[model samples]
Target: MFLTIIVCGMVVALSAIRANCHQNPSVCLQAACPESWIGFQRKCFYFSDDTKNWTSSQRFCDSQDAALAQVESFQELNFLLRYKGPSDHWIGLSREQGQPWKWINGTEWTRQFPILGAGEYAYLNDKGASSARYYTERKWICSKPDTYVQMVQQSPN
Candidate 1:
């Protein structure tokens, strides 16, 4: 009877330890990004302080393995807005004036929040309004998927 109790206690202790170790599986996940890049959800974002035209900004982001920020959802748009200051920032929405807008990744623009004005490139102003002015120099935000590589533990069979 005493041996049975001892074995059960050891089993419970080991289970508790395992549960604690995996309380937050994300705690074991690691993401790699350049210095100064911000991590949110499963992505990395970089907000540039230097002003540049939309085309140039896109080039810079491409060099960094990212693209101009694409507001895929309201939550993402709000996240970008929260980081925005008093100045306008270039986003990934752009097209020939009077043409259907599209993201840098070639995705069609589907969101309705950023009602862009008649211009070739779109930007988000301090008021969270999205408008277009291709030649205007503005700060920019770049986003890319998280570079996290999960380390898998092998379980003994």
Candidate 2:
């Protein structure tokens, strides 16, 4: 009985430590899925190896229990940009037609648009950031897993 009590106390303490250590929110998702992904502001993100159209990329992210990243804040956007790979990857936002950008999931664009570099947008010069279409083959960013998130496995009896 004493040993069991000690183990229980230890478990609670350990869990508390884990939660406190990741309060920054930026690293919350990372704590859940470390392999092939990183966490930022309560979301996990993963870059794809294969390039696809905007619609197709959204579908791919859906299949993987994630969605295309939604840049909700400048800090989050900067985080994405800093960690984003060298290759011009597609993001979930685009002008589609006129001025306002849209998210692939139909969420209203709440985040400020990242300043585009020359020739950077959509299909025109994906190597850079200028056009606004889905046909472009630039690499893209996707969110972290939203369901069945893997957790720290407990020891077997």
Candidate 3:
């Protein structure tokens, strides 16, 4: 029932943008995200309850066809911080010994959010983000773009 309402709302939204979908295909349609994942904007997020080391946390997300969450802006970070509850959850940020922090996709971390404290792997906590050794066991967040979304092209009569 809840999903039906969401689908109906998405259909209304997609109707407005369907024409432009050919140019910016990613945002075109379909809110049919995976069952357990939460759909926000153009991405789907999963917060795990089970604890694991950073590498193992990432591995679990990989099995779900997603990667550890990456924050692009303050708003996104806040959304994560708010929804992540009290327990800290691993994100996709990490650094090699004495190297720069990078996301799982290998993109270098920017000032989008500050990394407080000291650890090689990053996690979401009350303070937004904090570093911890990769082996530090904790819950994790996984995310992936809403690539399953697609617009069904109409055939001319």
- TM-scores for every candidate against the unseen true structure: 0.72, 0.59, 0.75
lDDT by residue (tens digit), candidate 2, 46-108: 877888877787788788777777776778766776776666666766664456656666666
Q: Which stretches of candidate 3 lie over 4 Å from their true place?
A: 1-31, 147-157
* 1-157: candidate 3 lDDT, tens digit per residue: 2121133134334443444566666554545577777877667899897999999999999998899999987878988998899999999999987999999999999868788877899999988888989888999999986643323223111
lDDT tens digits by residue: candidate 1, 52-125: 98889999999998999888778878888888777789989888656788889898888668574667788888
Clashes of 1: 0
Ranking by lDDT: 3, 1, 2
RMSD of 2: 9.8
**Where does candidate 2 stray beyond 4 Å?**
1-31, 114-131, 145-157
The C-alpha lDDT values of all candidates are 0.72, 0.57, 0.79
Error of 1 at 156 (Å): 21
Counted clashes in each candidate structure: 0, 13, 0
- Candidate with best TM-score: 3
